[model samples]
Target: MRYAFALAAVLCASPALAQQPTAPAPGSNHDARPQFDISTGVDFERGDFGTGAQVDKIAIPLTAGVSIGSVRVSAQLPWVRVTAPANVIAPTGPLGLPILVDPTRPATRTTRQGLGDLRLGAAYDLPVQGIVASVRAAAKLPTASVDKGLGTGKADYSVGADVAKPLGAVTPYAGVTYTMAGDPEGFQLRNSFSGQAGAALRLGGSASAQLGYAYAQNPIEAGEDDQRIVGGLHADVGRSLSLGVYGSGGLSAGAPRLGGGVTLGLKFGR
Candidate 1:
């Protein structure tokens, strides 16, 4: 009976050991894997102007990466169709003074439909053993039309760092990001700083939940900040497949919005 009990304990621990994230020294591990995550969902959001709009975005995000020993390299591509209102700010601006000053312009509706921005970025994860810490840089390439109510078609830059620490039953992580505008004249610049702090809960085997808060500086457009509560879930649907969902809820009165997204992914390699 003693031998049988020991065998059973080992069997139950095997799965947990296999699912744990790689644990390197306090500052040694840096790269993740080449994983593809795709999510298509609707965002019921309100703009800085306190207007409500529902836009459906098909986000195909791909993260191809590899960590050698403790060094890491990875890239991610994000395509989104962020929808506001019909006559909303005329997509990209430089509007006539009349339109810019008129309070009724945003209230008008227009017949326009199309894609938004295309983002491509690369990151080098810094070496942090035991605990994980890395700096990431990204760029947003304008692919949508800035004219016909599509997008700004202007490039943007972002820089940030993230840190993760494991404690007992949970892992706590936090990070901050800053965005710079390219063409402040032709398009709206998002001059904001966002920070998120969350903890991960491991559930027996292949599932986990992360809940945290994200706060952003007041957006360029008054009354629009990304301050919200965020919750995310990850589950291994199969041996090679995983699913995730995330939701954000606004915290303030100005254009505070609520939305959620779902992700489906297939991973390969070790």
Candidate 2:
């Protein structure tokens, strides 16, 4: 089975509110300038992955990005550690989920640690009838070593779009993504589709909360699809710093049973 502890990693990095761009003030020049941000965080998750063997994973990801006008570009790289049965593979794809290569293979718990595949992404914002919309594209580079089971040893690509509408203190949003998987030796990974729907609620002051459901098609033919409930609370510290705490619970065997993590973000430029 494919366990999505890696999905928790992605949620920890980008909260729902963070993906919504702020509109510029009327006749303001600030929106035309460039803005930069950097973020880093550690995420941990443990699950059986439906293979009758425990799997634990830790990921430390560092990301940096610049936004010019309504366009943004970013890159992320993560150090990952995985402990699982020898039949399981670590950091299998773009989301860094571990895969159960062969459940019937002899079981020997082992640990592997190394750099994960690097991901580069770009997005463009579009405002339409009071709704914030954006289109995004991303590529995963085969930077991690396949021998160490840190990646698929092939590049992957994805495209997606998101839209959010703000009403008073609440914003409702939804997004869909399509990914083209790269086949590795002895494995035929299938393309997949994923989506999320959520709402962010303002809790007064500098804090906000969000809750969402995520679903994804399983790329492996033997596993069930992935489904989970994800939520988080985020707060701004002063002007440039922000912090968030998030968690997820799996609704299917293809996802981690339970996972949570914290993240810190810093903003620069303007």
Candidate 3:
């Protein structure tokens, strides 16, 4: 029953019903593969908190990509809104109860209702035989609120490598990313390093699943590290459409794991 529920959850996670560019970007193929490939999806994530922690947030991401020669570019814009039910701290005093207040007042906290982060970057393939290797560099623009629930308001940068190889029916991949956080205005967070590894499995021609792990450094002195194991399912539903569902769980209490979400993806052109 647990396996069945997990399978069902994977199937409904994201839209993998569309076709993607088989070959690398233009100059990447030394043969000019495809001009562009675009996909857009939304993820509804539920995160589990610690003993007395509360965290519930919804994020919608709109993404698109272009391949101009060996240079491939993709952009992701996310809109997030969160509500932490038990995040409220109240005063416990004499006459029955003290002052109790909802830290995240949705009605009054709608001010943080805009785009979260803007990511822009490009990937350049490194010529290799029987394998896929590339270097990627990107910048995360401060578009979301670090304060009032909107954005971090601090710009960040990331550089990493993408490597992939096929094994029987699965194509495994690994990557490492480092980000530098800018100064804070309201609640500017600290900078950290993140590492991720995953793979895409070909289940016939219209379906695939990506499973991986991610680890991030903790900026808070009293907190543990952030570790995540993520999985994503993609399937082609139509000629130019796809669906996906993604989920992640915390391997240990060192970080806030237990996260799951759903996505819908669309693609057009060859």
C-alpha RMSD of each candidate structure in angstroms: 11.3, 5.5, 10.1
**Model 1 error, position 154 (Å):** 1.2
Q: Clashes in model 2: which pairs?
A: none
Off by over 4 Å in 2: 1-30, 92-98, 102-106
Clash count list over all predictions: 11, 0, 32
lDDT agreement of model 3 with the native? 0.46
Report the lDDT tens digits of candidate 1 across residue range 1-270. 000000000000000000112111123432353333332222222333233443222233344544444344444333334344444432221110001112333644445545544444444555445666766565556665655445444566666666777676677776666656565344355465555666777665767776666555544565444345566666778877666665555574431355455555565555
TM-score of 2: 0.87
Report the C-alpha lDDT of model 2 over 151-208, residue by residue, as the tens digit: 6687877777777766878777677777786887778888877777777777888777
- Best-performing candidate as measured by TM-score: 2
lDDT of 2 at 206: 70
Candidates sorted by lDDT, best first:
2, 3, 1
For model 1 the TM-score comes to 0.68
CA shift at 255, candidate 3, in angstroms?
3.9
